[model samples]
Target: MRIRTRLLLLSLAVLLPAIVAAALGIGFVYAEERGINQRNLQETSRAMALAVDRELGTREILLKALASAPSLARGDLATFHEHARVIAEEREASILLSDENGRVLLNSRLPVGTALPALLPTAVQERRDAGPDVTIVSNLYRLPRNPDVPPSFALQVPVPHTARPHLYLAMTTPASQLQALFEQQRLPSDWHATIVDRQGVVVARSSDPAKFVGTHVRPELQDSMAAGEGMHPGMTLAGVASTAFFSRVPRSNWSFLVSVPDAELRRTGLWASALLGGMSLLLLALATLAALAVARRTAQPMEDLRHDAQQLGDGAPVQARSSGLLEVDAVNEALVGASERLRRASADLEHRVAEAVASFEQSQRALLQAQKLEALGRLTGGIAHDFNNVLQTLTTGLHAARLGSDDKVRRLLATCERAVTRGSELARQLMVFGRVQEVRVETFDLAQRLREVQPLLTGALPTDITFTQDVTPGLWPVTADPLQLELALLNLVMNARDAMPHGGRLRLRAGNSVGQSPAQDLPPGDYVAISLQDEGEGMNEEVLARALDPFFTTKSVGRGSGLGLPQAYGFARQSGGALVLRSQVGEGTTVTLVLPRAQVAPQEPAPAAPSGGLRGAGCVLLVEDDPLVRDTVRSGLEVSGFEVQTANDADEALRMLAGGHCVDVVLTDVVMPGSMNGVDLARLLAREHPRLRVVIATGYSDRSIDMPGVRTLAKPYALHQAVAALNEAMAG
Candidate 1:
């Protein structure tokens, strides 16, 4: 409709065809280059094939001439041997003469009386089967007397006598001769030459002859060779997948293969095309840019309006400007009005975005808190696993010391035993905090379990503090992991003791509660409330509000891990219960655990086995990656009258077993070095030696527990526990 618009459209219409023509020209040039390269490769392959054919033909002629020597026709054997030796020395090949029955009369490589190998007779028979005067080129083989030499082929010809050919003459040439033929050709370094006999075994390769010669050609090449000489893409004998041009050797079943890697073949054509295409593209871009510039200059009125409209769309202030044309002036005025309205709308949107951002930040803070707790739980689990193994060694060693001790020594060992027991309890508490320990819930009397834990509680309290317990008679039984509940109670007691550095009263009380109003956010149900109250320095409202947060401790750094209260809270919530705390500074702190009461009565505890008389038998194979843990456990097992052998990891353990070491039980750590870890080792042993028993000992709970059908001994186990586990495995 407009002159400027029509000019812009006309320029693009002319430029588009030019760009297409340039692309077509580039593609044609590339195709022509590829065709030339393919022909060159075929010619090179044919020349290499001709070279190999000439080498074989020359060897055949030399063998025929040796058969016609004058000394051999007479009865003078020494003269014939001397003539053969001279011919063999000149050709640098092994020459042999065999009787019609295939016994060697003379061999250039070996002594005069040495017997010829079966290969010579086979070649003679093949020649006879093919009719008269046909030369046979045998497959590659090693010389009979000199096996150390490279692989060689036999060129066999029957000596023509008045009698029916009593003697057969053969010339042996090593594949190195063929290698020389390939080397003489002037070809590209990237091209590889391979010559294969009719059997598809490589007689020579130009690239790394020692590595590829005597190997069979790749199956793809074998298939292609059957159809005669041609160019095909296949894997080479060097194991590189490539394109090959092959030619059949003249007058022979052998083949000559020339290979060029696909990348190398395409490199030259692509480089030439890339140079030409880049120049063409640069010129085309320049032409298009020039055309657009001229068109924009001719259409100044429309260009000014378009620029103002773009500024309005991007929410930037648009100046009140217009082209002198009547239609563009009217459009500019409308855009100015639209721009004002958009500015107001954008302001309103900004106000709402501020409020949304504030809400999002609050949600992010809460999410970050949960993630922090989860990360701490993982850290605690890993630490507890390693700590448990250390304590296991300490526990076992202390028990061994206590066994043969004097009265004074016995008292010291007792103290050491108490400390080891405390260390093990600490590791278990860390596992609970980490949420790594699997919970086993059973109906249990709450009061009785707390009473059993009281002695440990009292031992942890200060001498000036007084401890008291009051449980309502016939308290309601709660269904939970008793061990976890006991640990939670101990945590609360320890907090109360720390509150009262000076003398104070610590009381444990349990009662039945039936309403939801008492504890905020607790479900309405019948519950047993176990409370620990201390008359000690306590928390204010501010400190108490953030008390349950993980790593939020008022105590000085290094004095507290800040995980105690959160651990108790996690345990209570996971057991379908709630933890509540109420306190005021300088008055006291009272922490209560409110658990839903079980509907049924509690089950009685199982009778304990007599651990004192427990002894392990049968030879035990101990596998632990840690040297200290392994050595300590081995000493303990020996003291317990069990035979023990040790390995650092599963691989060494397997080596020992394979070396014929006898063992009835395999005690292996779950994680070890090598491709096979303890779990993998157990599975292999299960199939290979069904009679052998496996005891998987692990300090880590996560991966170890997931393995099915294997007995796991959690570390640091006392020596007796390990022995008990082994005995159980042996018994099963």
Candidate 2:
């Protein structure tokens, strides 16, 4: 076929399908737009409903606060009435006090000595009496004495009194107060919003609220209101057709409805489709004309280009010639330079290929190193878990044995307990290195914490190396896991000590920092920078670059695991800070930890320790997968004046509970070999036996238990500490 004929046919084929696609897309766009409008309606309804509920909640809070006044509690009605009147005026609501017989004792809206009617609704009284002490919201009603006023509702809170058990404190809020909630939404002028109580009586409206207040919704919306929340085609109370969306208010039976006129919705879709279709048709016509012009202009130029390509492929030099068209003329000029460019490209191909291979090999080596480090972290995490369990067993056994031992034997047991504590610390370090440790952040004075750890830091260094400390007088408090911070500091100090084999001075300094550190890519913020500087042979550029990389070290294999600096770096970053290192080959090395400053002040000192005595007495169910830990914990609890039941795992614990093995508290391990872990077991117990207390014990730092009202005891806890936790849980 001729090129012009082909181009004309191609344009027809493409344009025909495009027109059909545009037609189809109009339907999709219409549906999408309609869905977006529906979602907007629903969201607006929800927002308005939330606002209404928030207003009601505020009134209920005020009434409850007023009910607790000392004047009311002491039967001083004159003083209480004065206070209630002030509060009612401030809140723009009326406060009423009623006796058990539904007779008003005091009404903030009326004079103190005026005779009041028994105005409490029967439903409000019955609901409050049937359920626990709670706030009850009455349906819309008019005051019996003042029927001319707007419709209102009451928020009733029961007051605990010695003589009058059913004394009620009620706040009367005009339904019009809810109209403000609708106005806050700023809905389109064409849109309408309504709020209806449980019985479908209109309490408030965004449009003509005064006319519609206290009126029942139209029959067309009765079924939608029954469904609680949904979208449906309906008519507004004024008889205007609309697409309405309704959402039920939280903590109440009321519903909020938002509606847009059907005419407006349909008009919007029609206008968008009409405009889109018009634009598409115009573009299609222009494209057809452009295609025809191009086909006529390029047909001869394409022939010339084909001949030039054949000459170049046959290794013959071709003479350049212009073809009038700019693109064809450019192609002719390119043929003149093609031979030289190809020659140069071929000459440099080998060098480029070698460089690409070198880059790929380096990437492959780095990837392999990353994979090895990842596998090492997983192995380390598992080892840490089992090691902590062993330490817990040892610690528990030492505590259990020291109870009745003589002075000498008790002293020996104390030494063993210290060793167990050290082992636990080592396990925690492994977990930290594996990035599996849970950090409990708290605000603490860094200088005070450093002073507390001075003994440990000084003990870790050799006597030949002198240690010096210089802390800023008013250092900023920082937020971090205090234990982790201590561990990081100890690791840095140890690294400094190792660097100075020969006697050298090591200085520790802490001060506040601000702004950015470009070298570390530190963000601009307030920080507490703690630096450890040493006078020793420092790291070279290459060593410094990989200093924080996991398992990269210069020390002998048995001497170091190479996780010290890396762990410190991870801790700093996790605490929203950065670690910075500045070093040279000969001039000493300085490692600085730039920790974000705490926004809150440091907490007060903890209370004094409880007396050293076992103070628990309850039946305890002990669940543990490890036999040694289970036995040690059981013996300790039994010695603390408790009857103990044993279960190997969650499944066994469930069976024991099902078989009517009564226990006051269930102390279980979090991670176990079972269908359910300790957290799951605790939740199940909570649902099935809510009155029972639960205490979870786990050595794995990464497990986060979010069960409120349940106690958690870290593994390797002393007998007294476990007893204290159990006691607290039971009391709670």
Candidate 3:
């Protein structure tokens, strides 16, 4: 086949399916538009129904108030009639007093001596009989003597009378009052709204109130309403076709209907379909013409290119010419230059191949380094858990020994306690670096915290490298783990000191800032930016790019673990902020930690700890994986006046509990070697023995426990702290 003919056929193949899809999309849009319209109409109908019910409810309240009139209870019909008339005038309604048999004893719309006809509807009487205090709403009804008045409904409440308990007070509200509600809706002119009673008789019509009031709705609509509330197709009273939505008013059998003419609903869909079909046909015609034109213009050029390709393959020289198309012309020019370029390309290929091999080797080394770093992080976390256990054992043993020592021996024990505390801090930092510990966030003044840690920050730097602090006045408070923030600052100061081996001025500056650094990607909010600037040997771009990467360091191997900057970065990010670094080779490096400002005032400092050790009387179940820590803790608890039982792990604890070995409180280590951990055991006890208190003691845990009846005591705590934790848990 000719090229033009083939191209035209291809165009038809592609265009035909697109045209079909366009038609399907148009059909779906039409259906969806119809659904949206129906839903809107349903919502409007429901809102109007609620309005009707509220209007009726208001009138019912008025009737109940009238029924409790002192004059009515005293049988002073004249005085009661006067009061009812005044209320009726104020509410634009008519009040009537009726007997249980539906006889009107007094009518607010008539004189007191005038004889009144039976005005109570049977629905109201039946509803009243169902419950004496129940408010009843009757269907559209007419007063026998007032036939000229508009259609109205009755709201009645049974009178609470000592002697005449059967009496009822009623309020007659005209259907025209509902017309005001419809007007408030401000529906489109073509739409119609109506309120109908249980019998499907129109109580109020939005379009023609006088003509349709008290008239029965169409049989089709009546059937739709009988089926329940929803959208249906029907004709308006004027014989115009419409899509109708109906919803029943709450607390009554009456329903409200909203209708839009079918012409209005289908107009948009019909026009869209016609317009889309016309556009699709025009597009197909234009595409076919373009395809034929393109094929004609490129056919000779394609032939020439094929001949040149054959020549090049045979190592023969080939001529080039313009082919009108840019792409085709480029291919022709390439053919003319192919012979000379192929010789040069062969030499360049070897060089490119060597570079590719070098790049691949570099990438392999990087991948290996990354894997090693990841393994190290996991190993660090595991080692930290055991390290905490050892620290706890030493802490508990020292406290137990110091309980009866003299002042000289107690002073030595206090020094040992300080060493244990330092060890615990080291273990916690390892857990934080490994990303296994949760941040304990609290609100605190950043400026105050910086001042408190200034001594430590200054002491870490060399005397030659002067340290200075600049804090903005009235610094906004920030929320974060205060202890972690202090550690991060210390790490930054150390890094600054390392950067300036020759000793240069170092400054720590803090101030309030908005999210001004686009590179940091901090969220747009108020933040406290604390930056440490050093006049040291700054890093180049390559080194700075990987500065926050774990285990990526430039210092000598033994001098740095490459975790300081990364840990600070992790802390900033985990606290809902960002770490930003600015550095150059010669000038200096400035590292900034942007922390989110606290939304509330800083909490007041906690009260001082009690002076003496806490003593409690109870059988305590101790669960620990470390035998030395368990024995030490049990001895300490025994000295505090408690019977202690020891278990190796969570499984043994559960077994002991299952065997009915009663204990008032369970003190378990969070990180334990068993099928379950301390958190799991605490949750099980919470479910099975809700009254039992649980105290979870741990140096560090990857998981957090926030359960009732559970208290957490940090590792390396003194004996007094453990006893206090137990006492608090038991009391709680």
Candidate 4:
């Protein structure tokens, strides 16, 4: 409130905050300089290490590729010169090959007859003894024929020589090559590098090392060599606190030590800190001026807004000259417009809300219609399944009737039978298209099963066509509906073969592919992929896009079914997978069947032979709610000579079993009777008569059955097919 006090407070606010910022800024600069120096040192060291590692890694790959040369694999030297020269050029290292006894067979630089050093390194010797490879560092300085460059180091990569029992691959890189590498790297000013031998002799030095080549560290520190205690900061040169670091050269016992001087680190850090401090003060002055200007400018607009708000609260009209500031003018204009709009919009919102409510009701009705359509699709699927069962029954009885008739009548009936069979197949395909058929799981090794189907795959192709199998090894086991998988593959392979009437390469490849993310056009997961590629007439992009839709095909009608891909698509969907098509107009088409990798594998095959006499003569209880189905099954059993009793559902079947009646088998349908289905009835009957065989029959083959011991049969069964199941049921 007082002028003196206000001045004091303002001074404190300005200078106090300024001083705090300066102190923090200066401290951070010092910390940052130290961090930068350390980072530079670490990064330089890592770069050097990585450089060495890169050379080593590249050398290893070069050595391996050289060892696998045509001359090496075939063991003939007539073509060896070009191969050896090519390897030398690629690796940038001289290559020398020798017999197990160290007699030089081939050298990149010298003639073929040149002799090598007699004493081979232990690494090379042992490698020659081992089966695959002999890789190690050997001091090549002792070898006379070794290059005249300084003390040399060589990597002896020995692999089996084709012509002889013991042969080797010696890849030599001169020590000077590495020293030159160390020499060329520009380290900090006053920073030097040294590489010492195992005996502490300085083998390589960046600076003039004539004075200290063979010198040893202090004996006290030398005693801790095994424990690595010679790495502390110590006096190496005047005024330089040299920090020593060490690492043993990989694949060797020799240790390498590098000394980084603290004076060099501190010299850069201190200078940087001073420079940073000067900059901090200058920035603080500028920032203080900017902050003051911003605060004054911000407060002016807020002050005007506050005055307007007060007048508006008191119900007074505001009149002021428009500021030249565009933002300020815009804010004032917005406030005026908002006030007027609020009054008018309040009355208008009710009418708009009523319109919105009507729109919402219309949208709700459309959604209901869509939901009903979806529900109708589901209902049609259920009815189609029951109708399919009736069709199967009609076909089965016709076949049985034809079997008992004369040969000429049988032939005529066969023509009608073909029509019926085709219709049944069409119905089955349609049901799949409509999403009625679900998954029916049978345990089989997918890779082996695919291999077995190779014959069928090629059979569809022309005689000149060549089909190749590109199955990846270590293919994981898969659990899925085997029948559906076969059908899907059948469709793809048949399509591929049909495309190439003149015969081209038809490849069926299976492997693990990481599926793309949904955002990337394919859904993400590990997929077991079976790709069928044909070097044939590929589809255009327009046709390919709609390839999986029902009745979308390029083939001439009557020659092919348009449902091949659609059926495959349905099968893939039912089996928790997807069917994808990729094609180029002139290039080949590839059909990829991607199934999710199964976590639970298929069951192993039974070790023992399955028991014979699956048939048994016993009083059997057949539970069928459908009278026609019951009568047909009873007639088939009467011909097969097994006494049969009847029931309508699970409860009736259970009642008869519990009534102390003699019954050996409880045959029932799964989706039937009371609260208890056939699965539940079977479970109860299993415990009731542990010896009685329980058989479950279903019209819905794709329906899942989780009960352990029930033998499942899909209907409209023939007398023989039903007999086989009954025999297996009656056996137990």
Candidate 5:
């Protein structure tokens, strides 16, 4: 998943439970608070009911005592009235009495016979309303002359004296005392106790009496008064919701109502829940944010790793970043290390690949050389088969003409012979091209040889150009194929000449090279470096690198043969040397031929010899594959006064040898068209003709041959060359 999505999921995973728990926890706290509020309200209601019951019990006892007193019926002015007055004073009440006509006869605080209109009317009304012998309680009314005082209750006791249900007397307990009882009642903060008459009128309230007392008691209060028991119920006064409980005083027919606002009971719980929930939400939100931050920090390392991996995959270098968290830091460190290793490994791989390509190219070059050599061998064999016959004919014809010679005809024959010689030279050049030439290794001073060729090089160049030879003195001699080395130098010098067509200076130089350094791939050793340089129009780097590639020529048309540099390169490698090239498009080029230096013996002065060279004293065996060639050679020997025995092939020569022909030399064709060539024939006669000197002559060469103690002569040779070769063979 993507980073944003993953972070979101992680945040949710961590935060989900917190939010849920906070909500549930808040709910639980609210419920607990609500329960506590309810319990407190219930306790306050009971407290309020007890307080009301005590106050009502005192009022009812005061009312009963007044009703039984005989003076309480008469008046406060009579003996009974004085007694009643004393009783009222003791009870802290107001009292009055009435006659049979329902006129007030005595007033507890009045003079001897006072008619109080409110009191007399209240008494008469209670007398008229009373049944026989029944005590009745009256509603509160204002006394006639005492309107300032609140209406007091009429308690009528009908005596068996007069017709109007006897005289009725009534008394009132102090309303202030009744109200003080309710007001002092203990209740919860939101609860209040109130007293109500049996008619459901509000009388005394624990709250503000002026406002609440005149207000009708709640329906639950009325029910409590009617049932004479307590009841708890909910009420709405105006819009405020409250819980009301009521209980009545049993004897007094008064009610106690405790009203607790539901809002009050729930306020603490609601506020607590609000405060807790708000805090929890804030805390949870912060926690969620923190969790997201932590997750992102942890994931940072992975993100960097992924990005770096992508870069590497796209072939860029790997990169890493740092994070502060420990695990993230460790992961980042690992990734950083991995990236570095990958970079190193990748660089190593690229280098190895380059080396592998170079190795493959070398193998391909070797394979191509092998294939070319095989093909050349076949071609050479075919050509030699044809040319041998032609040579035999020309050689024989020349012999016959010289025997019957006119000087001009002989000269003409010499010209023909020259043509044959030139053709033979061409054939040899081709053989060398096929790498089929026999090589003889001998120690020679390469530097001296180069010095000798310097003057010749100067003569060959134009006058405007100068040849400078920096031949290091005392340079070591080297063993090499001298002829091929000379050819390679010629090709390089000619290439240099073409580069500097404007006649620039050329340098032929040799020195030791520190190879396999960054500057060169040659090892540190003694080297014979023959450098040919010119202020020439040089090649670019692309061309320089591919300069030795076969058939790659920048020269136009026949102006150059591409084989020059390639041949030089091949020859150098075959001779255990290296050819390094350098050039820039504007600057000149340097072709350095590096060969391992060799040691040589110091030269000794020689004296002149006798006119004729030494000759062994034995008959010479001539093994010639061609009859005409063999006869011609035999005649030359006879003329030279040397004894000779001849055969057309190795087998015949062997038979003649077995027949005891005494030979000082075995002269034979090296590439005879027979079961055995001259080299094999020489081997056969080697022991028998131990004193024999073997000389080989051929028009072709097989590069595979490694015969020793042999001197090779080209076909169509003059008499002098044959004599010279024979002497050299004997000398060796």
Candidate 6:
């Protein structure tokens, strides 16, 4: 072999690789360009679809508004036709009003007295016949005035009150409006766009719409799009091979298409590649001289920009300096802007974190307060149950003494009885705070009920304080226990009186709320708000936080029981309502009850009852769990001239009955420790001794009990009340 042949072989090795590399690079560039063009066509199709959907939605809203016009409801066809004409001309559309049988009564494009025509197609008429209230939207169809006129579609809505049944108000818009929407998207000039309804009918076309509108789309395109929105490569309606993308319009049974011709894209890509090949030799000559200078100029600035970006990521400030080159200067400027934004962002993030922490602390405090209130409520309920038993003994013993004592002794006994009555009221307040008190719900006008209690409220206030009322005249009726509402009102009024030590104004206001505000917790509906506003020393946030807790009072020790606010809160919640309190130090306080409204008819008022009480004449058997209560009640009944037998519990009472004791009535407590409580005992007696009378009495009774054909006596009852219950049971 020759030395020259060996050198030629090495040169061929380097040149062949360079030639192959250039060919591969050109192919990669063409593939990337094709992908970019495909994505751009898809995005353009989706944008056009969205724009057309918005246009149709605005038209639908307009049709619905015209359906609610007063002129149409009043049977004034002339006025309604004129009004529809003005609206149609302003929006560049046609309007029609039709009767139940689909006969056109008025068309905005023609004179009002023109002979009527059938305005709806067969498909639309079938839907209306099935359900007259249905909204009917039509596909594109030819205009009736002339075949040369543009195609149009109709939007129809039911007119609720018109001269004819199943009347409709329809608005017809030309296909030109949606074609204009497609054109407004500023898509590439060579791209073709069309809007089609669900039935494959072409409603609008960007190119030559006069020929394509109201025509069915080609069978090939319809079959491809039937599966859903997507892209495909196929021949277009005009017999040109193109890449087409389709998308569905939101909230409508319509779709849009964007098509780009493959021939046009291929021509552009070929021309670009040819120009690049021609410029390669010229660029090679210049590159040798520019590379050294370009590298020297850009190295420092590029490095500086990179280092500053890292600092910005670390939450530190950066200052960027520019290189003289155009591209490098652009990068430097972006870095500087980014660094400044980073500083501002860091400060904003710190501020947001601080606010979040403060909110979390406030929520934690509120949760703790609620838990404390719940625990206190449970404890208070237990104490109240035991306290009522003691009061029952005192009440019955005092009533017995008052009946048999001399003049002076009777006066002393009356004082004891009054004290016992006040104690019983206190126990009742505890039950209310625990949310265990039963209520008898009824529907009544809240405004009228407030007026009935106005006199009592005014008399309870101090002499130095003036009272004012601002009740809305025709407020909605509310469903609640009337007795509980009156007691809650009295409690609020008394609290207001105590707040103003010297003198202040107290106002009671009632109003209706539509529950539109987002800050309210009530469901979306109507409510009645009753507010008690007082001008006195208000509470601080810490005091307000625990204001609703049981036995939580700001007053001096012996001056308050702290049950007033809790009772009001409990009652409101138990009645499907809410209580809201707003107070500020050195300002005033306002407490409002948001009670739900009810739909109930008014009933005639009943006559008031007489004052005299009933008498007793039966042999009574008294059964109670507590010994003190049993003995005191039994002694009272014996003194009242009724034969009395006593038992400590239901089991003992059942034993006495099993022994064949003679008794006219059996009185038992509803809650006991044994397996058979008072309600169970009564059920047994009804079955075993069918003719024996029964009376259920309890200081704290469970509301779940079902006592049929028996009288009930609420305790802390006086001797006279017990005797009355006995007589009532005997008579029944």
Best by TM-score: 1
**TM-score for each candidate, following the candidate numbering:** 0.45, 0.37, 0.38, 0.29, 0.35, 0.35
Candidate 6, residue 535: lDDT: 94
Q: Give the better candidate number (4 or 5) by TM-score.
A: 5
lDDT of 1 by residue, 1-732 (tens): 765768867877888888788888888888888888999888888888888888888888878887888878875668888788888888888788776666677888676666646544557666667655667778777656777988988888888772654677888887787777765786678788888888899888878888888899878778888877788897776667689999988757789988999888888788878988998889878877887788777688787888889999899877777567788889888888999999999999999999996885565555544643653443454345446655765666665554533643344344445445556655565565445677788998888877656655665566578889999987899998977886677667767766787888999999888755347877687888988899989899999999998766676433344566887898788878888999999889989888888989999866433222457678999998755467667767876779999998888998999999999899998756567889899998888888888999877756634433458888768778888999888888
TM-score of predicted model 4?
A: 0.29
What is the model-wide C-alpha lDDT for candidate 2? Answer: 0.79
Query: Among all windows of ten consecutive residues in candidate 1, which has the lowest summed lDDT?
Result: 605-614
- Among all windows of 10 consecutive residues in model 4, the one with the lowest summed lDDT is 607-616
Give lDDT for model 4.
0.63
What is the Cα root-mean-square deviation between model 4 and the actual structure? Answer: 29.6
Mark the 10 consecutive residues where model 5 has the least summed lDDT.
607-616
Off by over 4 Å in 4: 1-36, 85-93, 99-103, 120-134, 139-149, 160-166, 179-185, 194-232, 235-241, 245-258, 272-732
Model 3 deviation from native, Cα RMSD in Å: 26.2
| lDDT tens per residue, model 5, 462-526 | 55667778877677677787667766776677678778878888888787654342125556666
Cα lDDT, all candidates:
0.77, 0.79, 0.79, 0.63, 0.64, 0.75
Better of 1 and 6 by TM-score: 1
Report the candidate with higher lDDT, 3 versus 6: 3
lDDT of 3 by residue, 350-412 (tens): 899999968855655556455436445434545566567667766776766656446434543
User: What is the Cα-based lDDT of residue 182 in candidate 3?
Assistant: 79
The weakest ten consecutive residues by lDDT in model 3 span 605-614
Evaluated at residue 141, the lDDT of candidate 2 is: 84
lDDT of 6 at 632: 69
